[model samples]
Target chain A: MKTIGLYKYLPIEHKESLLDLETDRPIPTRKDLLVEVKAISINPVDVKVRSPKENVEPSPKILGWDASGTVVEVGEDCKLFKLGDEVFYSGSITRQGTYSEYHLVDERIVGHKPKRITHAEAAALPLTTITAWEALFERLRINSDDVEGNKEKTILIIGGAGGVGSIAIQLAKWAGLNVVATASREESVAWVRKLGADEVINHYQSFTEQLTNLQIQEVDYILCLNHTEQHWESMGDVIRPQGKICSIVETEEPLNLNVLKNKSVTFVWEFMFTRSMYQTEDMIEQHLLLNNVSGLIDKGVLRSTMNQKLSPINASNLKKAHALVETGRTIGKVVLESF
Target chain B: MKTIGLYKYLPIEHKESLLDLETDRPIPTRKDLLVEVKAISINPVDVKVRSPKENVEPSPKILGWDASGTVVEVGEDCKLFKLGDEVFYSGSITRQGTYSEYHLVDERIVGHKPKRITHAEAAALPLTTITAWEALFERLRINSDDVEGNKEKTILIIGGAGGVGSIAIQLAKWAGLNVVATASREESVAWVRKLGADEVINHYQSFTEQLTNLQIQEVDYILCLNHTEQHWESMGDVIRPQGKICSIVETEEPLNLNVLKNKSVTFVWEFMFTRSMYQTEDMIEQHLLLNNVSGLIDKGVLRSTMNQKLSPINASNLKKAHALVETGRTIGKVVLESF
Candidate 1:
């Protein structure tokens, strides 16, 4: 089977950073679904993982997490998915990822793809949707079922035009929260507004002054998809007492948890890979969230966040997608189709 | 009226650290409950507030929080309690505190005194119970109502023999969680064991080794009443994926929040004064918890944590109580009565 694999971690500018290879197809094992990959999406994690590192791999390493494909085979222990099931998943970080013609993934983390969207569009949804869903519903404990009660509440999304933020804005709005999103660029501001953000602020400006100008005192929740270290104090200043803050970005420095003490605020980190990495008992939650997102998409409540699409999933197309995402200001996701 | 007041923050050994003074009695207004103080408890907050500072107060500052007294008067807006009602509360830190013969507290922060206990016993409870209850059920989001479900979960309470930890052990046990508490002394270990801790370990020893020996891998919840900086790494090491940790003790250094990122653990600060200090919309939740605690005490489901009693509340006994608490080995709360 053909695969896009890396022999060494290198900058995208280098010729050998990503390469085309012919590796033996992965076989379905216990609870594994052998996905015949159709489409894949590039995220920040893919860039971070493929960035420069000193050590070189003895064997080729695959590094795509978000994919939409058809399950050609399933392990005997798999009860959730069957053969020829069209599915979407952000596969586990610890396992061999999805940058191959055939990939093995735990069926418990795969969800039936949305019938309303194409495979490329579906590929764009899994990673961002799962991240937004878990960060808001699981980590921040936002009661999506209690829309009426949440109507009076608000959430501030930092970096609202990015992959996770694009979905998070819509989810927060769907959950009946007034969405306050931050975007430094005019295009990004317009993009988040299109994604259901009620208000957009410039991230480069003081969040305090911006919120004051908007006649907003404080937010009940904050979902940060940007540099947490840069926004830590600002988020602390604007987060309401007893509020919650969830961040996906890891900080280079230690945070003064004291700033959150007086307000009794809760700070949680959301890494979508946690469940799969830890193989937690609740790993099936990802499958459930993806299914719900698929349903929501099919129902026309949510739209695919695919901003750009490339055809013929090869090393060059994958490289192009990676380059677009690496710009760090892409409005949404960049997906590649047809390996 | 008479009060124990301090004009300067001084060492406990100072001659004028805490002094008895005559002052005009305060009147009740706007949900204020003018309580005729009967008993008061000294907590670590008292010692910290009275700790030496460079700045001196222009007027004597009265410092006490936990108290059980009879409501001599209630403001017109106060419907929770009326005149002559026996009540207990951890009064707000912003207001003049509970060290006076006549003290004013918001009726919303006060609760009906336990029917089964004396004023001194009840006095020992309000602060610690509120802190423990909020930390567990609210911050940790432990469903105390779901005892059957909670039976499968466990909590590791650092400093579980201290005032807050004493009540936390009992509450966690009542909620059907397996409670593992930490204590170094023989007497404290015995005290926490009596309070229904499923197991006890020395805080000075390695928590990892001890838990491994006990056949416990990781805990679902961690209530930290000891040094958070000292235990931060160990707590991070043992917290189950998606677990919750609440700490009352402030850390001297910035915490590396990234350590808990992979596990997706939650870190919440539980300051009992948060609601009162912020005058949050949920300030009344404290009142509700206290009333529920009162009911629990009356029904024998919970007990007061008073360990020592000093009569004729004055500078000498108060100073001695402060000295004892400063030693940081006291097993339970200390109550002083009869001003």
Candidate 2:
């Protein structure tokens, strides 16, 4: 199998940053599905993990997560998927990633792909979709089923132009919440607005001031996709008393949690890899939520977030995709299809 | 009306730490209830607020929170109570506290005193009960109604011999969860065991090591009543993936929140005064929960934690109560009754 991988972690500008090589294909085992890679997407994690580092891998390290593929084989223990099943998943961080002609993933984490969408589009959805879904419904404990109850609540999605934020805004709105999104650029603002944001505020400005100007006293919840450290105080200021805040971004510095003490607020982290990393009892929830997202996609309630596409999955294309994502300003998602 | 107050913040040993003053009785208005004070309990907040400081109050600042009294008058808008109704409450931090011959409280934050208990016993409950109940059922989102579901979960109550932890142990046990409490002193260990803790760990040592010695790997929830800064790392180490942590202590130093990111853990504050301080839409929850607690007390499902009581509420008695709480080793709540 031809795989795009790296032996050395280097800057994207370097020729040896990523290389195309032939590798023996892996076999499915114990609830695993051997998937024929169809299309893949680049996320911030891919760029971060592949960044320049001192440690060198003995073998080529595959570095991708999101994929839309067809299951070519399944282990005996696999019950959720079978041969020839078209599936989509953000494979476990601990495993060799989806940047290959073939990939192996636990069937419990894979979801049936939306039949109505192309593989390229579906590839852009899994990682961000799973993240947004869990952050809203699981971490923040939003009652997605209770639309009437959700109508009285409001959520602020910081970095609304990003991949997770784009999907989060739609899902929060679908859950009947008043969705206020943050986007600084004009195109980014328009993109979030198009995705059903009830209001758009700039992340560079004071969230409290902006919300106040918009006549929103405070938000019931906040989903922070951008810098957790930078927005910490503003989030504390604008979150309603007893409100919840969920963030996917890891902070570089310590946080003064005492800021939220008086209001009895909640701060929760939403690391999408937590389930797969820990092999938790509820790891299958990712598969379930993905299927629900697929259903929503098929029903035309959600549109694909894929904004840029590259063809012929190779080291060159992946490097380009990585470079684009590294800029940290890419709207929606960037996908590469067909090896 | 006679009140115990302080014009200056000073050491508990100072002669002027608390003073006996005569003042006009306050009248009830709006949702207020004018209660004839019967008994009061001293919490750590009273001691902290009375600690030596540079600022001096023009008028004496009254200090006390947990109280059980009779409603001498009710405001026109008050519907929860009427004249001569016996009440128990942890009044708002924003308002003057319950250290006088007569005290005023909002009806929404007041509850019917337990019929089977003495005023001092009921007085010992409100502040700690509200803190524990909110931390468990609301902040951690533990479903008290689903005993069978709760049976699989475990909670680690840090500083389990304190007022909040004493009630938390009972509440968590009643909810069917395995309760692991932290206590160093032999008396505290016995006290928490008497209050229904399934396991007792030493907070002075590594929680992970202690729980491991007890054949428990981790806890699903952590209710931190002691030093959050000191226990922050240990709490992160012993919490299960996707676990929730609720703390009532305010950290003097900033916390490295990144420790819990990989586990997708939740950190929430459980300040009992939040609803009343913010005048939140759900401020009435305090009243409703307190009444439920009163019923539980009457049914013998819960018990008061007051282990020490002082007679004839006065400046001298309050000073002694403050000193005891300042030691940070009070086994349970301390109560003062009968002005």
Candidate 3:
């Protein structure tokens, strides 16, 4: 089988940063679904794992996470999925990724692909959708079922034009929260507004000043998709007393949690790989949320975040995707098809 | 009116640390209840606020929080309590405390006293009960209504012999979670176990070592009643992926939140005074929870944690209580009756 992977982590400018390889095809086993991947999406995690590192891989290490594919084979214990079924998922970090001809994912974490969208569009939705959904409903524990309750609430989404933030703004709006999103440029600001953000603020400016100008006193929840360390203080300042904050970014410095102590704020991390990394009891929650997102997408309550596409899922196209993600200004998702 | 307070922050050993003074009696207004104080309890917060400092108060600053008394007057807007009603409450930090012969408190944070317990016992319960209740059921968001579901869950109460932990063990047991409480001494271990802790571990030793010995893998929830800075890493290690940790203890230094990122753990600060300090819209929830706690106490599902008793609330007795709390090893609560 033809696969794309890295032998050594290097800058994207280097030709050897990513390579095309011939590896033996993987097999399905123990509740696994052998996915014949059709489309792949690039995320910031791809750029991170592919960045310059001191270590070298013994074998080419696959690095993609989001994919849309067909089930070529099913493990004996798999109960939710079957061979020939179309699926979309963000595979576990601990497992081999989706940058290959055939990929294995646990059936429990895979969701049926949205029937209304293209495979490329479906690929773009999984990782961002899973992250935004979990960050909003699971980590922040917003009662999505209680629209009436959320009608009185507000959510501040940092980095609004990014893949996860775009979908998150819509989801928060759909859940009836007043959405305040941060975007630095005109295109990004307009993009988030078009995606249903009620208000927009520039990330380059003072959050309190912008919020004060917009008449938003405090937010009930904050979903941080940008640099958490940089936004930590501003978030603590704007978050309502007893409010909740969820972040996906890793911090380089220690957090003074006492800043939020007087307000009794909640701080939660939302790593999408948590379930797969820990093999948690509720690993199936990912499958459920992804399926819910798919249904919402098909029903037109949500939209796909795929913005840029390339063909032939080879090293050249993947390198382009990685470089775009590394810029940290890509508005939505970038995908590659036809592996 | 006779009142015990401090003009200057000083060590408990100082004669003027907590002085008996004559202050004007307070009047009830706008949801306030003027209570004729009967008994008051000492908590760690008292010791902290009264710790040695260079600054002096312009007027005496009263420090008591947990109190059981009879309402002598009610404001025009007060709807929850009537005059002469027996009540127990952990009043707001912003208001005058219960060290006075007459004290004013908001009606919404007060609860009907448990008929089964004495005034001293009731006084001991308010602060610890409110902290334990809010941390477990509110901050950690444990589903107290689902006993069957909670049967599969486990909660680790760090500092099991403290005032909050004594009641938390009972509440966690009532909610059907397998409770693992950390206690260092023979008496403390026996105390938590008697209060319905299913397992007791020594906090003086490595938490992982003790939990491993108990055949426990990880906890679904952790209520940190002790030093969070000291126990942060241990709590992170023993918490299940996506588990919650709530702490009332303030950290001496900034925390490295990255340790729990892989597991997507939640860290929440549980300051019992948050609602009152912020005048949050849900301040009345305290009244509701305390009433529920009162019912539980009366039904014998929970019991008061009043371990030591003193008579005639005065400067000397308060200094003694402060000294006991300053030791940081006082089991349960110390209450003084008859102001």
Q: Write the per-residue lDDT of candidate 3 for residues A1-339, one digit (tens) a residue.
A: 989988888999899999999999888889999999999999998888878998989988999999999999988899998779999999998888889999999988999999999999999988888899999998998989899999899899999999899889988988888899999999988899999999999987888899999988999999999888899899989999999999999998998889899999999999999999988879999999988988998999999888899999999999999999999999989999997
Candidate 1 residue-wise lDDT, B189-219, digit = tens: 9999999999999888999999999999999
Worst 10 residues of 3 chain A by lDDT: A42-51
- lDDT score for residue A64 of model 3: 95
Which digits, one per residue and each the tens of the lDDT, describe model 2 over residues B1-339?
989999999999999999999988999899999999899999999998888999999987999998999999888999989888999999999889999999999999999999999999999999999999999999999999999999999999999999999999999999999999999999999999999999998999999888999888989999999999999999999999999999999999989999999999999999999999899999999999999999999999999999999999999999899999999999889999999
Give the residue spans of candidate 2 off by over 4 A. Answer: none
Model 3 regions more than 4 Å off: none
* Pairs that clash in candidate 3: none
Q: Could you tell which candidate, 2 or 3, scores higher by TM-score?
A: 2
Of 1 and 2, the candidate ranking higher by lDDT: 2
Q: Over all chains combined, what TM-score does candidate 2 have?
A: 0.99
Candidate 1: which pairs clash?
none
Residue A117 lDDT (model 2): 99
Candidate 1, residues A196-277: lDDT per residue as tens digits? 9999998889999999999999999999999999999999999999999999999899889998999999999898899999
